[model samples]
Structures are given as C-alpha cells and as structure tokens.
Target chain A: MDTLINIPTMAELSAKGEQPDILFWVGCAGSYDERAQRITRAFAKILKHVGIKFAVLGTEEACTGDPAKRAGNEFLFQMQAMGNIEVLNGYAIKKIVTACPHCFNTIKNEYPVLGGHYEVIHHTQLIADLIAEGKLVAEGGAFKGKKISFHDPCYLGRGNGVYEAPRKALEQLDADLVELKRCKSNGLCCGAGGAQMFKEPEPGKKDVNVERMEDVLEAKADIVAVGCPFCMTMMNDGVKHVEKEQEITVLDIAEITARANGLL
Target chain B: MLAQIVFTLVFIVAVALFTVQVRKIIRNIRLGKNICRNDRKAERWTTMARVAMGQSKMMVRPVAGLMHLFVYLGFVIINLEVLEIVLDGIFGTHRLFAFMGGFYSFLIGSFEILALLVLLGVLVFLARRLVVRLKRFSGVEMKAWPKSDAIYILLIEVLLMTAFLTMNAADYQLQSRLYGHYIQAGAFPVSQFLSPLLPSSTEALVFIERFCWWFHIIGILAFLNYLPISKHFHILLAFPNTWYSNLNPKGHFSNMQSVSNEVKAMLDPSFTPPPADPDAKFGAKDVVDLNWVQLMNAYTCTECGRCTSVCPANITGKLLSPRKIMMDTRDRLEELGKAKDKNGASYHDGKALLDDYISREEIWACTTCNACVEACPVNIDPLSIILDLRRYAVMEESNVPNSLSAMFANVENNAAPWKYAPADRLNWAQGDWSKE
Candidate 1:
C-alpha cells in the first residue's frame, strides 16, 4: 500500500535507511476527487502491468491545507503540513510520485518551507518513462485515427512547467490530438477548483465550465481527455447540461493510457 | 431680472445634486472593502500619472484614443470660455478682457476652433458605441434614464459652444464687440457677422453671453456634484485609484507562515491533527473582513474595461467578469459602509464574501493566471484578491475541492499532489542523471 506523505527531515530518513526508490504520496485530490482516483488507479494498474515495481502511498492521507490556506486559514495548512511530514518520516521517504498536478506542484515547490524536501514527479512523466524504457509496447496505430483534445490543468502546466510531458505521453498512446484555442500558458479554468467542488458556483450570466466546454465543442474532438480530476468533473458537468447523448466522452490521461494498453 | 434669478437658482440646485451624487459613488466603493491593500503608495501615484492622467489606457485603441484625447483637451480649453462668462457676469462686459481687444479676440478665436474640434471628437466616441460596436470597446452599456441624463449633459455643452460661435459672427452687436482685432478681424468669416442686425447694443451681447455661459458651466458643475450616484463617477475617482494601484511583484503569493514550525512533530508519524490555535486568522471571507488595502482597490477602478478584455475566463464566456468584480465591490462597499456608519460595526459577520457582490465561482474560477492585471492599464492585480479568497476557503472553512485536498495530501506525504506515487521521482531524468 502507498503512504500518504513525504519525509522532510534527513535524520528521520537516515534512521529508516537510504530513502526508498520512491515515496508514493497520494493527495486529497486523488483520494476524494472522483475522476482522480479512477485515473490514478488506471496509472497504477498500467505501471504494474508493464512490470514496474512502484510502492503505493496515500491509501490513507490527510489534506495538504492548500484549500485552507487559499481560503485564508494559513494556520490550518501549517498544522496539516506538519502532520503529513511526520507520516513520511516514519518510512524514511525522500523521493515521491503524484498523479495530481496541484499536489506535485505544492510538495515540489511549497513543502520546502515546512522543512519537507523531496523529488516529486507527475504520473505523466512516469508514463513517459514507461514509453522510453520500451518495456511496454503500444498495441494500436489505430488509436490515432480520431481527433482528441487535451485540457491543461493550471497547476500542472503553468505552476510546475510540466506542459510537454503529458502531451508526449498522449503522443505515445497514439492519440490524434486537437487542441483548444487557449492551451499551455493560456489554459481555461474548468470552474472546479479551490473548494469550488465542495460548493455551488454563484449564479451568474454563465457557468465557467459551460464556457470552457464551448471551447472543447469548438475544437470538434471525439473525446475530451484531461489530466486533472477537477477538469474531468467540470467538463463532464458542462457537457451533461449542453450536449446530452452527444457521444463525447471525458477521460483522464491515465484511463486513456490504460485503455490503450488493453487494461481498461 | 426674475428670469435670471430663477435660472441661477436652478443651476445652483443642479450643481449641488451632481456633487452629492459623485461623493456618494466614491463613498460606496471605499466602504465595501474590495480594494487591494498593500505597500503600494508609490504605485498608486505613478500609475495615476502615467496611466490615467496620460490617458495611456485609452491609447490601446488608436481611433478611440484619438477621440478621447480631443474631448479631454477640449474640455480644458473650453474652461477659458467658462471663466470669460464668470468675469462678464461680475463686470457686465460682453467682451472677455475687452480692455485688451487684440488678445481677447485671439483667445476667443482659439477657443472657438478648439470647441469645434471637441464636437468632432465627441462624435467619434458616440459612433463607436452606437455604430461600430467594437468587441473590445463593448461593456454593460448604460441605458434608459441614465443614458438620457448623459445625453442631456453632453448636448448642453455642445449647444452652448455652437451658439457662442454663431453669436460671434451671426449676432450683429457681438461681432462689433470684437472691434479691431488682428486674428480673423473680419466678423463675416464667423457666424456672428449678422449679429448687428438683431440687437446692436452692449447690453444685448452681455445678456446673450450670460445665457450661454450659465447653460454650459452650470450644467457641468451640476453634473459633477451628482457624479457619485451616476455611472460617470469613474471620471473623478479613477485618478486616485490608478495612482495607488498595487505595483508589487506580479503573481506574488503571500509567504505561507508556519504555525507549527517543528519538523520533529511529524517524525514519529502517528498523529493527524488540526491546529490548536484558538485565535488563528482564516482566509478573507467578507468586507471589513479584508485588510485596508484590498478594500481600497474597489475605489480606484477607471471602468475602462481592460481587465475584462484580457480575462481568459471572461473571453471564454465564463460568468466571471473583472469589470463586474470592481462594480460589485463598489456596490457592496457602499452598502456596508452605510451600515458601518449607522451601527458602529460592520454589517457582515466576517463572511461578507458575498456571492451577490462577487460570485463564489467567479472568485475560484480564476487560475491565478494574472492575465487580468497584465491587461489592466491601471495595474490592478485581481489575482492577489483571488488567492486571498482561496486561502480563506481552504484554511478557515476547511471546505476545499477534493482536487486540492488530494494535492495537499500528496505534497504533505509524497511531495506531490498525486495519490499514486511514482517509484522514481524523476523517471525521465534517470537515464540522463546516470549518464551525466
């Protein structure tokens, strides 16, 4: 089973022995963000299928306090971060892996202030690794036959500079990709973030997801694939209201990859 | 005499109302707490001079910029004519500086030429709004009673200028008032050449000048005082707001302070606990709910619509509009300010973070992308406010999206916002690292 946190101090890490090959850190987004769990499960299953021996983490993990801090509760975030670091210290974990882009960014970028420092990579990079190793061969050239679109989650592409990894992973999966007009640095918000998933958006002239879905529809793709869980929920909700029975499906990169590997 | 007295009283009343209205609008924005507050005094002044005063924002579009420039410059130049009327009222002389005929005539001619240019400029602005309807230029266009008031104010100024020029050449007596001046000495060239045919007396010209002058100055002053309530309030307050605008590092996140600064607190790995800080501050949830500076920004918007134009979420047709953000802040601040004054306390219970003023989705929908600020000519950073609100949602309320919760957990445990840990943190860098 994967652990929930990262070991920030070297003393705790040294006590346990040399840090494990990877400290598997499962974030709040992954555990509770419905699509994230499905995507993460697919990524794990795919890696396992291809003979990769990665440790599982965060089958039981607490929130990182990003939402608390963002919502103006800095004190809570600090408490949560400290508690999470203790969980990692017990295992002497130094290196880490994450499926959530926001988690990847926060741990890689934020936890250093809390005395947590470790190498972290998104699952997309791991998939890129799997592709590079030639351990798993792609089965179908037919996968690229139809057009597909990718949504860039803010934390993944802009916050962490991991723009190309996911796209490369998609290319490896042989997806015939179409892109929204605003991608990469100018990505659209899916309207499901910053605790927006917990509460309804204020009623206004339009829903942010509805606006973003219009872009996917404008791109005219057969399937809309996203890397982030929030993007999946928002795009799904947006399409549900606007294009019922429209035959367009929303899938995460991991799920898509799992399908490509004939594991789905 | 009775007619003049009645008109004077009417003009005074109009100006008073205009002044009252303008004050009210500004007061409302200050009271709402939607402004960005930080150590930004220098930014406020510099941006006000560079962006607002220089009309740098208007220049983003060439044609609109040019038209606005004319109106702005014309309004200043027209002030000379207004001063001339004030003097005539006191001295009872139709001629502006009649003692210096040569200079007075030249000044009059120059002002007339400038007024004509202003008319032409105003025409372009009207056409853009009504005829061209440029996408970038479009906004929540004011209409109905407000529109009528706006038109009424503009028309009065235009008519006074037109009539002044006509009386100069077309009015026989006023034409003689210029006497022998060097610049365009011939009255026939201007419309007032025929003024001698009407009432060729000094008293008649004086009477006419006062009539036109009152219509122009009184109308504008009246409008000015009433501006607080009117949509045109931006003209008065945009300067101070722009001058004090945040000029700090763009997209700079507040340094996250540590409440539990102990690294050893987590070494044993057995506990998951919330903070025991009984008096800890959570995220910003309302007005008076914000620090002084974020509240100040609500007061400074020029309403030039630049933020909305650059907003990616807005361009995508999201309900989030930056322009509306400022407007709603102004609206709510006014509401709260009144209550604060009335009750000696803030009306909201620390959660003034109202959906009615600024929608919750609009607040969270922002990706901390900084596009709105980058596009703002006045340099109002909307991203900071968005992040501040996010902090409140996550920390105080403990109501965050599952996505962020996942991110928080991953970063805390594995140093990544992911559920499934990668066996290798840098899987792509592995081969490169070994070779290096």
Candidate 2:
C-alpha cells in the first residue's frame, strides 16, 4: 500500500502558474482519521492512474462546516464557511471533489447559499465518470467473484439522491455486488450523520450503527463497500462490534477500485 | 314560535363558544415569532390544492387514503346542509332548500351517500385504532387523553352523522303521512330506508325529528369548538399549513439570520457585524422562539403517525419520533396559551418547551434526513423544530454531547474535526502507507 506519489498542493499549483482540473477537498476524516486516510490515498491513486489533473488544497483546506452546521452551531459553521469561501474565491477554484459525502454535500449544496460556488463532486462519482469515459479501466482482478455490499451514506444516498454512481463504481469491479434489504432511498444511516460522528449516541433500544450493521451482516457479504469516509468508519466499527472483523472487511469504493486496478 | 326562540338562543351560545375558541387559538399562534413565507403565491396555492383539498400525499397508503378521502369529503360537503339547517332554524322554515326542487334532492341524496361513507370510514379508523392494534396509534406519547381524544372525535362524528340521518328519517316519515307542517318535499333515499324504523304516530315522529335536528346542529358547534384543543385541529390548520410550506429544496435548511449577517461581515472588508442583543435567544428555547409557521405546523399535525412510522431513527429504536415532536410543541403551546389566558398577557412561568416538553436526547437523535417532512401529508416540517432546538442547545446553552465538544474544539483550532493540524492534511497522500 505504498502511495508515494508526489501530491501537488493548491499553493504549488498557483506558484506553477497553473490550476488543476479539480481541487480535491481532503476532508477532516480523510486528512487525519486513520481508517479514512486509506480512502484518501486510494482516491488519489485513482486520480493519478486516470491522469486527471487534480491537486489537494493541502494546508489551505479547511472543513466545509458540515458537522458544525448539523450540530446546530450556525455561527461557527458560517465562520468556517466564510473562511473557506474567501480562500476558494481567492484561488478562483472552479471544480472540487471529495471522498467524504459530508464535505461533498456541504460544498455542493450548502456553500452556494453562503456565496461560495463550485462544481463539487464525490469521489465515487468521479470514479464512475472515469470508468464510463474509458479513461480508467477497472479489471476486477482479485475481486472478480468477491461478495461486496455497498452501504449507502445518508448524504450520498438520501441527502443527494446519488444511489447509482457508487453502484456504477462497484460495477466496474466485476464483483458480486449485493444490496441490503433497506438500500437506496430507504437506506438506513450508520449513526454517524447529523454530527453524530462527534457525539456518543443517546441511550436507545439499540445503536443505529449496530442496527444498520445487522442489515449488512444479513446480506452476508465478505466485503462491505462504502462511498463516504463517515460510512466507512461507522461500518468498520459495526463490523468490529459484531466481532466479525476477521471475517468481513469494510472499505470505501475508492479502495476497492484502487485494489482492483493494482494501485494498492 | 317558542321553538324558534330557543333555537336562536342555542345558536348564539354555540357561535359564541366557537368564536372564543378560534380567537384564543389565533392569539396563541401570534405569540410565536414572525416568518415570511409569502414569496411563492402560485406554489403555495398548488400545495394547498394538492395536499389539503386533494389529499394527494394521503394516497401513499391506498386503503387508508381512500377511507380518509371519504371522511374528509363527508365533513366538507355535509356542511352545506348545515347552511340550510341554520336558515331554517332562524326563519322558522321547514327544509329551507326544499323550494329548489331537483337541486335540493340532488344535494340531499349526495349528502346521504357521503354520510354513509363517512360512517364507514370512521368505523374502520376506530377498528384500526382499537382492534387491529396498529403500533403507531398506541405509543407512549399517545397514552391517556391523546388516545381518548382520537377515539372521542371519531365517536362524535359518528353521533353527528347518525343524528343527521335520524332527523332525515323522521322527516321522511312525517312527510309520507302528509302531516301539517312536515312538507312532502326534499330527497331522503338513504333515510327513506330508515323511515319504517320510526314510531308510527306523527307526534312521536315530529319529536324525534326535532330532537335529532337540535342534537345534530349542537354537535356540529361542539365539534368546531373542540378542534382547537384536539389534534383534529388539522381540520382547520392543514390548508394554511400546506399553503405556507417551505418550497425550497427539501435538502436545504434555512440559514439563521444572525449567523448569516455575521458571516457576511466577516467576508466584507468594510462591513461590521451588528450590535448583538444581550437578551436575544440564539434559537428556540420555547414556543415564543419558533416562527408562526412552525406554530401553525404544531396545530396542523393530524397525529396520524405516518412520519413516526417511516422515521429511520424510530425504525432503528431511537428515541426520536417526529410525530412526538409536533405533539410536544402543540402541548407546550397549549400550556403557554392557557397561562396567558389565566394570568396577564406578559405571563412567563419560566417553563420552556426544550426540557419541559422535548428533550435533548430526542432532538439529537434526528439525522435531519427530511423523511418526516416528506411523509407529512400537510407538509409539517418537524425537522425545522428539531434543528432550532438543537441550535439553542449548542449555540446558546453550550450543552452538546462530549464528542461534539471535541469536534468543535478541533474545528476551531485544527480547522477539521480531527486533531491533526491543517498542514498535515496531506500526510495520507505522503508517507507510511506500508504500515497498513
């Protein structure tokens, strides 16, 4: 899993008198969460493999204020949003992509209302697009017959109505992709949405993540695929909760694609 | 002459009671903050037509939807006959619309058919609640008076419709006998079947007709007054609720004004943020903090449990139920309304809707998924209430879950929800992948 490629930063590109085709918004989870870092690297590998001109905002990147807003701190959220908008408007960045559904949703849907507008895309959508254009070929390789189930992230599935792009990315792998009983629009949350990722779940009959994990387990897939880093964390935790960590692996669509393409 | 005088007195009392209830409700709703939803006139009207008038969203469950459509039509269309009843009571006329001949017959016949359908609908609804054991109807929130209120409304409608039919039956019986004051006029086909069941003596028949006529009219008045105190208040509020619905994209949440202004000031070089009011509430601490439309939504809740049934959090055993949120708002609003009525206009007993009615755990459980908003036939936005309350908890009270506190700290200093500084954001792309 050696991802030693030279990653260009926004500052570096500005110094080079050039701009990348897309500004990769490496979200908080992707930037620092150990489990989510793999997703960031995998997506970066796919971007490099496809020869797409992409650059990370690097140190210049800040959160899109999704969690802050969802947590009901509108003041903090707007402060963060305004700061990012200033930097983005300064650089005149046009197209942006991120592997985190939370960031993608905030930037695409919430930012424009705060005076920041860009062509925002999620990484699965990018991978799906690349595969469709035949620019990046996903051969399935070792994953040809593997059982994989995609857990739809709330922001990606219900928030954004993007049930197909992730599936398309998985389809490129030629793996046996399965559906949870409550997939697509009726998909359940992984208990990490609405800023719940930062808070312990309130006392309930059952944790939302454990309940959602039951659906994944019922599907009995060896590999659980996710499109969002938040979903990856929650689903991976769900797998661990049931002590099925040795039997099942939770991964992002980018990781699966990267693995299938021999990049990882 | 004596009977007409008594009818006038009864009418005056009923109207007075109904008017007082309505005025009280309006005043209570006014206690809420103002919001401007008047931007989209055509869309608002269309929403009212489709949701309140057409019951379009109700049809998602065909059996219940069609049944509700029948009951709704019965309640609306049968009221036209009340116009005739009122005129007759005031002017000492028998069957005031009888002069219209065929049209009167047609209207009466249609009313009879609708009444029958309404009776059947009410019966089925009652069965669903009492016998069929629908889980949504028998929840903890719906215990005691909530359950009784629902059953009582259904039974009252049954009684009203039955009284109307009985009065029609007695009138038909008297008309068949060609009694002096009982004109041989108007249609009564459904009641015609019930004419044989009336007492043979014209004296007893007149007594039956007069008793039912008074009962039916008085019951209608009672129902009108009861609406403000009942979940069936939706009967009056749904039209306006649907009309004032937020027509924005379902995923979009309205930005707070104070927050937006501060953000604008931050972005502009020459701009300065407005002076903050020390007494200003951050979000909703009580019903007074919520917008009028949200208060209207509280009144508009039918308590059908459709939103709660589909709520993912509720489905997964979370404490959050959108139905309960609306109910709690209405209950707290009612409590506040009662206090204002009892005490002075400036009354504040220190109880707020936040902890008193709704809890922090319930508000936090919501994912803001808009599932409840989507499921609401009347377009009640429970998510908005949840967000506002959460806003109060986080921004004003500084009382969020410990994990959220950590995330906030990270966002403030590290520019992310994680502990890593912004400079190390690209570490994932740089080194140490071999450790994996």
By DockQ, the best candidate is 2
Task: Count the clashes in each prediction.
Answer: 85, 0
lDDT of 2 by residue, A82-191 (tens): 89998998889999999988888888888898889999988889989988998777887878888899888878776777889989988868789899977886677787
TM-score of chain A of 2: 0.97
Worst 10 residues of 1 chain B by lDDT: B427-436
Clashing pairs in 2: none
**What digit string (tens of lDDT, one per residue) describes model 1 on residues A49-74?**
77544564433355665555444446
What C-alpha lDDT values do all the predictions have? 0.61, 0.86
lDDT of 1 by residue, B124-153 (tens): 656655678656555553335444545554
The TM-score between candidate 2 and the true structure equals 0.89
The fraction of correct interface contacts reproduced by each prediction comes to 0.20, 0.59
Error of 2 at A171 (Å): 7.3
